[model samples]
Target: MHDSCSSPQTCTKEQVVASAAPERTRPEEGHPLLEPVSAGEVRAEHVLRDTFGFAAFRPWQEEAIEAVLHGPGRVLVVAPTGGGKSLTYQVPALCLEGTTIVISPLVALMEDQCRALAARGIPATFLASTIEQGERNERERGLLAGAYKLVYLAPERLASEWLVNQLARIDVSLLAIDEAHCIAHWGHDFRPDYLRIGDLVARLKPKRVLACTATATPDVRREILERLGFTQGDYAEVLRGFARPNLHLHALRLQPCDQIADAQVVRAEV
Candidate 1:
């Protein structure tokens, strides 16, 4: 994985891993992370420390979190992999009043994040086809009861009228769209179900929405904003530079027949 340092603070890979570890005690009802700040107030640093056990924010993470927590509430975050893009919304999710709905494209990614949050003593769950109906029902009950801070679902799951109706009943504090580039037709990865997310937002009327992606060009970003029903000046945008000094790229030119010989020679040398 590539290491990214967009902020002047310079965060190391060790620091990032250490922050994500579930070593800190979970924030309780009286903890600072659980305390609600007034409108236009920013308590992200508190959440970063008390919940994630991080000493600082990476690049635009704090700004993005503040936007969702106190600003326009519509945000688009474009940061490279390992740039703490998840924390932009996750931090705000902890401070918000209701459950945060995350629409992710990959089940494994959702499962991994849910597990990580659970390990940190944060309530999180996901809806996936691999789960049995009994478990799904139980999870749904938990969702309605506000037993979770974050609830993940696949983009395709929004197509279900029953599920959408059920979500409408709950107070959705935030709606986060992971891999948001999929909403753009010209993007490298496009999912048709993502196109319906704007409709879902209108139907559910979540108080806030955040779209995050690791790769998106200027045009693709504009398309994503449009797809999510965001007009110019209606949303906040946080973009971290994509320069990875620690990651290097090299290219070698060889004929098709020479490829195996080159690999074998390299392996022998190693």
Candidate 2:
């Protein structure tokens, strides 16, 4: 959520990568994951259409989901802000047998996502500093009993040995790192806590990993992959172009006298 302002403002190059939306397609276009599943198998498109109520996958989302569900190892997705990055992992979380643990930085964002998922009949929860101790304990118990399909937690929560030990006992299929650019020193919002994620992954050893972000330079991307224990040949990458014809960028200048005119124009538009 970087702001663009007039005069002497700093911005990341990644923000300029926006592009027109590419043609949307389902995984069945070519991916094996789209094949018809048997009785016990999980079909991704079914989850997309039935669970989330989306007809088709956004550009690059199907490929990213395929990589996570069927690829050999980890996956990294660097899509634009409105590029449906959450589905890259959320869809897989539903298809996979075990739970998916999402590591995010913002408690408010976690709550919002968890609430939306719950409304859609998806079992999701979060534990953050904002919650009361009693409610936190209830969520912890629910998480341990395999009552949730997705669990959102802050990186700080991993510092707790007790919590980590409890998580170790569950069947964690995917470890999704959202806003993954924080792990890189060159990122605009580098965080020291994210550096410990590699160790956490090593200890927890989830079956697969998925790192996602909206903006990242090549150097930052490299640092994130290395930090997440992804080797050159072992992981998959899904990088969608950021060009959208519908998206527009504008910068305007105004003096004290111009404010009145601006207000009048805004009022008319409203």
Best model number under TM-score: 1
Q: Give lDDT tens digits, candidate 2, residues 51-140.
A: 899999975787777667765337888888877999988998998887899999999889999999999999999988778999999999
- Candidate 1, residues 44-145, lDDT tens digits: the string is 788789888999996578778766775456678888888788898788888877899999999999999999999889999999877899999999999999
User: What TM-score fits each model?
Assistant: 0.78, 0.77
Give residue 37's error in model 2 in angstroms.
Answer: 9.2
Reference-based lDDT, each prediction: 0.77, 0.77
Query: What are the C-alpha RMSDs, in order, of all predicted structures?
Result: 10.9, 10.6
Number of the top lDDT candidate:
1
Q: Against the hidden true structure, what lDDT does model 1 obtain?
A: 0.77
Q: In model 2, what is the error at residue 161, expressed in angstroms? A: 1.5
